[model samples]
Target: MTATHHTTVELAKLARVLDRDPGDLAFLATLPPEALREFRDQITDLTARREARRMQRVGAAAKIVPAPIAAKIAEAAFGPVLAAAIAGSVDPARAVAIASALSPVFLADATLTLDPRRAVELIAQVPAPMAAAVARELISRGDYLTMGNLAGSVPDSVLRAALPHASDLDILQVGYYLEETSAADRLLTVVTDRVPGVIRATHNAGEWPKAITLLGLLGPTERSKLANVVAAQDDEVIDGLLTAVEEADAWDTLLPVAAGMNPQSLQRLAQRPAMQNPTLLTKVADLALTQNLWLSLLPLATHLSPTQLHTVAARVATEPDASLTTLIEQAHTENHWPTLLPVALALSTPDRKRLASLPVMHRPEFLTAAIKATATHNLWPAALPLLNNLPTTTHDTLATTINTLTDTEFQAAVQAAVQAAVQAAPAADCTATLIQILLRQDFAPRSRSLTLINEAGNLETLVGTITTRDLALWEGLSDIRTEIPGHLRNLLAAQATRCGRPELADNLTAT
Candidate 1:
C-alpha cells in the first residue's frame, strides 16, 4: 500500500482501538507522495522508539531493587506512577510478590494508571477488596476496555467484589468486548445475585440490543439463569427490550437468548401484549421453527391469546412434517394438547390427514388424551376440522379410542361439539362438523347420535351436502342409532321425491 493509504489505515485502526470517531479524510489522497512517505516514516519511528523506551523502563525497574524494598520505595517515590511502572515492567511472579508487599490503598491507586494489558496479568494477586475498589475506579473513569481485558483472567471472588462497582453501561461495554466470553459468563454466574441490578443498568443505558447480543454468548444453562433475571424486570423493561430489538432489526441477536429462556420465562414473554401483534408473532413463529425451538416454544403456545395461538399454530402446521411432528410431540408431552388442537385445525386438509395418520398421533394414549383435552377445554371447534379431515384408517383408530371413553367422557365430547356449534361465531361450518363427528359410522355411539340429531339445528343441509360416497356414510349410522335410520328414511324419501329418484328413495329403507 502507498504511504498515505497505510497511514490512513493505521490511523483508522488507532481510532477504533481508542473508541474515537475516524471521520471522512478523503483529503489524504491529495497529500504529495514524498511528503506522505516522510510523515509515515516519522510516525512509525516515533511509535517504535516509544515502545522501545517502555520495554527498557520495564527492564530497568525490575533490576532496581529487591521486591520488598522496591515496593516501599516505589510507594514513597512516584506513588501510583512508580507502582504503575512496576505493574507494567516486572515479570508476573515478581510483580505478584511486590503487590503482596504493597498496601491495598497503593494497589488501588496504581490500578487507575496501570495499562490494562499489564494489569490483567497481575490482577489475581490483588486482594478482593482492592480489586473491587479498582473496578469502581474503572467504572468511574468509564474504562471498559481495561475491564474487558481483565475480565477473563480475574477470579470469580474478585469479579464478584468488583461487579458492584459497575454501572449498566460498564456491564454492557465490558460484556461487549470481553476477550474470553466463558470467563465473562463465569463472572456473571458469580454475581447472579446482582443480576437485577445489572439488568437495570443495562436498561438505563438503553443498550438493550447490545445486552441481548452479549447474552447470546453464554451456554444454554447460563442463558437460562439470565433469562430468569430478564423476566424479573418490570413490564416496561421487557417491553423496551423487545421494542429495541424491533427498532434495531436485531432479531438474530435475540434468538439464542430466547431459545435458552426457561419455560416460565418463556410463558411470561409469550403472554406480553407485544406478543399479540400478528406481525411480531409471525416473526417469532418463523424463528422458532427455523431454529427448532419447538421444545421451548410449544409450552408458551398454551399462554397465547386464542388469536395469537391460532396464528402461531397456522405457521407450525405449514412447516415440514418433521418440524410439525416435533411440535405435536412436545405439546402432547407438556399436556398442551388443548393448545395443539388449534394448530392442528389450521393445517391444510392433506397435512391434517397426514398428522392424524402419523403413528404417534394414532397412539391410543394420544387419541384419548386429545379427545379429553378437546372436551375439557371446549376445543371441539378447533378439533372438528381435523376430525373431518382424518383418513379412513385414522378414523377407525380414533373411533376405537372414542368408544373406550366412559359414558361421561363420551357425553362431554359430544356436548363439547354441541356447545361449540351453538357458540360458533359463524355457525355454518362447525355445526356441520358436529354432525360429521357424531354420525361418522366408525365412531358413533347410538345414544349421543340420537341427542345430536334432535338438538343440532338441521340435518337437511348436512345430509344434502354429502357427496355420493358419503351417502353410504349416512346409511352406515342407521344401525348404530335406531333414530338415525328413521331420520335418514324421511330425509332420503323427501330428497328422492324432490329430485324424482323414487328408486333411490325406496332403497334408503332397505338398510
Candidate 2:
C-alpha cells in the first residue's frame, strides 16, 4: 500500500478518457517509470480505436439502407434477427424514422430478437402506442425478463396501456427488478386500480421483499391503498409479512409505511411481537425524529413497554423545540394523554423544562391533564418542578383546582406537592405559590396542616405579598391565625393597612 507519485502530465489524459482514478490503476503502481509512459499510450490508442469502429458501423448502416425502404429490405433479407442487428447499429434518430413506418407488431417481434442493451436505446425511439403494443405482446408470452429490461426505458403512456394486460404477479416480479425506480414508480400510478390484487399476488408469491420494495416506491395515497390491503389480511398473514421483512433486514423499507399508518392500523402493527425488539424500536425512533413523525408515532408508542417507551422519549427529546411543542399540542388536542405523559415523564430535565414552557401548557385542559398524569404515574417528584415553573397566573389557577379534586386525588396532589417542595428545597417558589393558593381556599384538613404548619413561613410571606396587591387575600387570613408567627402577623397588619384595609389590619393585629 505504499504511495506512488506521478507528474500532473502523466495522468491528465488517461483520467479524462477513462474517467477513472489514476491511483486505481494498481498495475501501473509497480511498473518502472518507462513502462508507465508506454502503458498510457497503449490504453489511449485502444479507447480511440474502439470509439472509431462504433461510429463507422453507424455510418455504414446509414448508407446501406435508404430511410424509405429500410423496413421492407430489413424484413425481406435480414428477417427479425438480422433486422434487429441492423437497427441496433444505426443512429437512434435514423432508427426512429424507419421505425415509424414499420408495423407496430413487426417492430414488437423484432425487438424480441434485439440485444437487451440495444433494445433499451431503440425502445425509446418507438411511439408510445407501438411500445404499448410491444409490451402487451411481451406480457402475453410471460416474457417478464424482457419486460423488466424495458421497464426503466418505456414511456408512461405505453406502460399505462400495457400494464393492465399483465397479471398482478408478473407486474410485481417485473417492477421489482426495474432498472430505474422512478420509472417503476410512475408505472405504479397506472396500476393504482390493481394494487389490492397486486399486493395479494405478491404476498402469495412469498416475495415479501419485492412487495415491500414496491411499497416503498409508492406515493402516500398509493402506499395507503397497499397498506389497507395489508391491514385487511388475517393476523397470521400480517405476522408472516413482518417476519419476512425482518428476516430480509427490510425495516428500512417497511418503516415509512408504519410511520404513515392510520391509528387503528398502527395499533395493529404495534401489537405484533416483532415490533418489541429494542433494536428495531430504536431504529423506528430514529426514523420518527429525523422524519418529524412524532405525532404519528406517539399513538403507536402507547403500545410499547416502559423500557421501550424510554427509548422513544430519549430519542424524541433531542428533536427541535418546535417539533416537541407540536407533538405535545397534537397529543393534547387528540386526547392522547396516556401516550403523552409517559414520554414527557421520560424526558431529560432540560427537555422537560422546555416542554413546561410551551404556550400550550397555559390551556386549562392541558394543565389539568398534566397534573392528573403526575398522580396517575406517581411522577409527583418529577412533575412538581414542571408545574412550579408556569406563569404566576397558572399557579393561581392550579390553587383553585385543588379544592375541586376528589378527596383521593387531592391527597395524591398533596403528597406530590410535598415531595416537590422537599425536592425543590431552598428555592421552593412553586411550592410556596401552590401552598399560598390552596391556603387561600377551603382545602381538605391534611393539605391545610401541611401548608400552614410545616411551610408557615412561605404561606406568611406569600399572604403579606398577596394582601399588599389585593385586600381580597386578607379575606381568609384569620383561618390560619395559630400558624402565623408574631413578626409575620405584624408584617401582614401593616401591609393590609397600606392597601386601604384598616379594618382588616385591626383584625390581623388582634389575632
Residue-wise C-alpha lDDT for candidate 2, range 389-430, written one tens digit per residue: 666667555665554555556555555554444554312445
lDDT of each: 0.64, 0.63
In candidate 2, where is summed lDDT lowest over 10 consecutive residues?
Answer: 1-10
Give all TM-scores, in the order shown: 0.61, 0.50
Tell me the tens digit of each residue's lDDT in model 1 across 1-511: 1233334433443343434554654455565544544564465456445766775575477666788987877788768755675565667777877777877667656754455545566766667876787778777777665576577778788887888777656776777555445865886777666678878887887877667656655667777778778887899888888887777665555555665666678778877788889988887778778866565555566666668876886677677777666777777887878767766665556666787667677666777788778767767666766665555545555655555556555555555444544554222243344444455434347454555454434456544433333455445443443455576557745665576655555565555
* Candidate whose TM-score is highest: 1
TM-score of 2: 0.50
Model 2 clash count equals 0
Error of 2 at 295 (Å): 8.2
- Candidate 2 ranges with C-alpha deviation above 4 Å: 1-69, 72-129, 140-145, 219-225, 276-283, 286-311, 314-342, 345-511
